[model samples]
Target: MDDVHAVRKPRDSWWTVFLVDPVACRLTLLVADRTAITPNGLTGVSMALGVTAAISFALGQLAAGAALFYLSFMVDCTDGKIARLKGTGTPFGLWVDYMGDRIRVICCAAGLASGQYAVTGDVAYILLGAGVTVLDLFRYVNAPQMKRVREVVRENRAQREPAGEHLARQDPAGENRVPCDPGPAEVAAVLNEAAALIREASAQPHPGAHRVLRLYRRIGRFLGRHRVRPHLMSGIEFHAAVFVAAPLLGSWALLPVSTGAGALLLLNEIFLIYVLWLSTRTAPASPIPQRLPV
Candidate 1:
């Protein structure tokens, strides 16, 4: 089992050559050892390095800062690849990954804001901070609600255990039941399907679903394109393009009004984050068209 969880492998993207993918190169070096680090350990280390990078940037070191920050991004992707290669993905591990990423992102934003203040000593720093603070505050305030939503998801699927809560061994009779059993893709699929079923069943008697369906029709009264937007293909790409690239671009180079532009763009991301959060919270799950697992 340990060997299975620690096996080295490649993915469909398959950029194993060090020269081809420098990011993957750095990560592959970490995995080249006789043993591999656990996913959560990788995430934690990544967060630490990312935080250091952000702090350095905030302190106004550009070149070294960029290299470290980029390394952070490499580690972020590497952990996911390691999980995929070894099939060691666990709910607890994923939750840790998500939390670590969120913290790193927030720190980066804060670092940028601080850097602006340190560099310019202008009132614009206050504005930038305000925008970032708003987004951070919103996420902080909503985290509990999100936790509850996840819990609801678990309970809806008849999970007595908390979502992402790792279970310790429970002995029945003379036999050991299990110890820290964490499943991968198939387990996730089953849980998601079960949750979907619960959602479908729960909504069966609700008249609100019908009214919501009608509203969707009314909203789509105009013609539309079914093609996915350049902005929406993947969440990471969308978020990175909007939040990181747009804001930090001007700050990194001596471009015309780059820092100013980054500040304004940061504000837009705060608004975007709020909208996406609300959309997820209020989204009505349509009548599931698929059959339930028997």
Candidate 2:
């Protein structure tokens, strides 16, 4: 619906919000709404364009590859927006979108590396391509699982907390609260539970999470008044910016830019793996309560 697009700003990367969404995705969505085209169809188009972009890069057409890559991403963004607008989103569509994203990244990276290899005759470019693909794939897979776990924890907490208590805290001004959504207390509980799950899952005691949580709290405090989510480094945004700039730098530079992106992704993957390891660890034995005198 138009409502979805009109309300709060999309909680996506800033690049998406400013660079792609307003003009590109919106225009594409407009055309799609008027035509018989479906979201899945758009997704397929995106995939095809991405493959072509990759091939173009492999053949040493950096500018064409970059243009096609950007267009592909724009169409990819359009499919989801159009689906949400038309109320035509499906589980199958979601799956296709996810897989398409992965495949696109793989193709693009491989093409860039292949092109670089052609230029320099280095086999490391091939390995660099594999690293990029693996890093992006891990991000796609792990981030969602972590998010889902947090959601489950929040839902559990919301069911446990009293409605009046939530109303008193989050809706103290008597504003109408959305009945379907959880409140602040519930969200806080969900975060706590997610942290606990991470601690439990770790093989050894880890203080890194604790330090990160403190920083997270500080950012939360700063953003609480603005009601805006904090922006952080994201692989999606990183790669987007890289690809958008790579063509301008010429073919030889694309390799170094992509390799740098891959390195960043690897670091991010490490952080994610640490958190995931904590989430899967067994919780310590519960302490027994001592008897109190009557």
Candidate 3:
């Protein structure tokens, strides 16, 4: 049981942490203890369930489709937990997991759009489906690029700083660091530094931006104390909002809920982009590498 808990991600979407992890953890323990099923095998199960969910949606069984989709996601979460708990994780497993998620989203989107359009004879459902698919793709594609940009900036900063300066900045007290369990003070320090960087980058930043940053900092500190990330509308949450919440609201609420979820997702992504840009502005100048090394 302790080992199963240890497999949980240190930071993950609120949806996953609060809703999925509890269910996934028990299933993971059962699988690891009782079965010989591999992580890849679990991925296959998740994919199968996802396909069935799509079929349900195509048949206009919205509630059933939503429930199946949620179950599929639960199994998807379990696979990773089992892999981590048993130390059987592999790069191939990672690839399968990633591809499986993409395929599920695509199929679900098509199933949902077709189902809704058939019911209402509205062309807009088709467009909404495309919008959802595109938004998911954009989130996944842009996330890695944003991460790479941050890494490059960090590397550049490290290179420009005097030897030991970067390390000193990170751990000024020379205390041993626990990477997985950062304290609230540490989190606040990082947020404060980021706020300072943004202020320094802008000659006269908007009052609203300052307020937002301040609120973010406070929220970061609060969530940090509880070991929760401050990103409330990440990809996982977005998917849940669209596939689970929207459908459960019934056909009448589907379109509006999905549209609102998409908007929130975009807004969150834009906010992250703005922060990354600010960080880059404060980073030391260096030519970005033509390609990231393998």
Candidate 4:
């Protein structure tokens, strides 16, 4: 039980936290206790399941495909947990996991589009599949670049600010902190302040911005209590909604559900960009200090 708790990520997407982790964590424990499975081995299993799911989709077995995809995802989640628990994580394993995810998405999209078009004789399913693949690609590619930009911004800010001031800014309460683990309260406070700053920096603040921020804060606080992020429509949730929920709701719901999920994912990405821009805009412009002539 303690191992399960320890293996869980401190923060994760809401979909993983609510729907996947409970099962994944237990399965992770079982694999650790009962098997000689390496993380790479688990990755292989996940890839196999994902491919099977794609094949099922190609046959128009929507329900079966959904179930298998969900199971694949569950096993996918477990591989990481087991790796963390056993300290057997490897760079090769990470590469395999990342590539496996991309392959699964592409395969599933092609299979789904082909099957649906075969049934309905509509070209839109083909377009939808292509669009989904592009969207997923965009999200994955943009995420790392965004992260790199944020890191650069933070480094530049730290260099510009005096060391004492930077330290003070990081720990206003003057408590010693772990390097990467800012607790939920701190995260919520930072986000709330960012939203307020963004609102104030706007030429004409939206009237509903405050209310929206407040609701966001409330939701963030609620999810933070469970170690889940407030962004409910992240890529993980988007995938689950498109593949699993849409299938369960019947073939007719697939288009609308995918569209809605894609829109929400875009909105979340836009909001993040807005926040980053506002942070840069509102940041203090301090000059680098020069050495006086000796």
Candidate 5:
């Protein structure tokens, strides 16, 4: 029981921990278990809500847009919770979720720009929207590459561990090397579990692939702890900020604000590129596995 408690992933976001998880995710989990609603169904609803939110913003209904956008985000959070709890996630589900998120970003950003342009006649807002779109595209594109790098690291680490060591003892480079939060002890336990899974996957590729794929779903949870996460524009932080600003800033202020945010996100993309480069460059020269065709 203590080991089980020790291996549970820690919440990385205050918003998710204090608000979204306790309220939105739990409510969705209840509804999901009691109803016929599938996770993909939730994803579809989220997509519609996001598109509607964008349209509402374009029509200058800031309050409605903000509410709708929040609803979309809530459902987006719920679907993954449902997927994990129900063991229903698949490679196809991941692709759908990925596409849905991108669609929301594009539609919402474009709508905000259109509305702002209508109100102020500034072409710069259009450029801002384009920039957000580009950054979002890059973010999604980078995720698979990051996963590939992790797989390489996992494989390399597996090869380096002593042949007769226990799985729990075979910590790859030690969790201390990663500078984890939530104190060292809890992070150490989680990394042990992660290392065990990685090593097992490396040893037995057939059943291990499924196990690793299941573990891969938690990649976002792990990567959320990366030093560069807070700076990324195409993430929950920026998404929440956009919703909050929509109602408070209105069209006139929102465009310029979002433009600045998008610029920051673009800069973060460069940082992510550098991080990926470092990982791949330092990784052992093993052929990367073909990523899920998402």
Candidate 6:
């Protein structure tokens, strides 16, 4: 038996790619439990491939780097699928998953740092982005401390507002989303609805059926109205995607692709100040609980 505790069914059906979303992974695993590969083993394998890819990219071997990159993603996808299948993917495994993510992020730095300082012998533009990346990394690392500070401020400063206050606070453009802390009863209702949709989607041949599309549209409008987008404007997804694309594009042979990809990455990062500013905003309060400052 795996030493880790199985994660309670989490609510993450939309994140099949990372396969890190426990609840959706759980459902997927139980429903397809024949091939029995251990999740941790797969995690190790994926990490190895990720490190290999980073090394390849660092060495300026773009073709091999690209292939290994995809291979690492496959390992990532497969591990979660295996975990869900084996019922062994615990929160500990989830922690390991994030560690794997960190490894790749470092790999990204290694690749780019090599490109700038070693390969091209130019440290101007690359150094600038690297500093930004480090600051972004700090934002993530200090997220817990930042979250506590904010909650303290919120509890002390935010008076319980009447429902009317929600009107201006909810901006659909994903600007300044008002806090919507629905209590337990309301949270239960939302969970029930989400579970129902999942069941319905599973039964249908097209998961993105008419009903699902309608739900997606409604959600989009709701997010637009309240400006309640995922707290991931410059999220890990955008970070890693851009990191890999940069070297591949900018290779002496692929200059145009390099310039275009770099521009897109810069644009996305510049526009998404929300992510960097709020990585520590309102993360799920840790179960063990942190000491609040007096």
In model 4, the runs with Cα more than 4 Å from the true position are 172-218, 284-294
In candidate 2, the residue pairs with backbone N, CA or C atoms under 3 Å apart (3 or more residues apart, or in different chains) clash, namely: 198-278, 198-279, 200-281, 201-278, 201-280, 201-281, 202-278
| Model 5 ranges with Cα > 4 A deviation | 1-15, 149-174, 177-234, 280-294
Off by over 4 Å in 3: 171-214, 287-294
What are the per-residue Cα lDDT tens digits for candidate 2 across 194-229?
Answer: 355443445665576656644655664554434433
Across residues 1-294, which tens digit of lDDT does each residue of candidate 3 receive? 899887777656678778888888888889898999999999999999999988888889989999999999999999988888878999999999999998989899999999989989999989988999999998888766766666676688777878977555554442222222222112323334446545544775656656767778677666655556677677778889888998898988778988998999889888777766666667668755535556
Q: How many backbone clashes does candidate 1 have?
A: 0
What lDDT score belongs to each candidate, Candidate 1 first? 0.46, 0.63, 0.77, 0.73, 0.60, 0.47
Q: How well does candidate 1 match the true structure in TM-score terms?
A: 0.47
Question: What is the TM-score of each predicted model, taking all chains together?
Answer: 0.47, 0.70, 0.85, 0.83, 0.66, 0.52
lDDT of 6 by residue, 41-157 (tens): 677877898788767767767666666765565566556656654567798988787688677666755675575456677665366446535644654555444444544433432
Q: Candidate 4 lDDT (Cα, whole model)? A: 0.73
TM-score of model 5 (CA atoms): 0.66
Worst 10 residues of 4 by lDDT: 176-185
lDDT of 1 by residue, 152-222 (tens): 44343333334543222111231211111121111212222222332344545334433433333333222
Q: Predictions ranked by lDDT, top down?
A: 3, 4, 2, 5, 6, 1
| Over 4 Å off, model 6 | 1-34, 125-129, 132-136, 142-233, 252-294
* True-structure Cα RMSD, model 3: 4.7
TM-score winner: 3
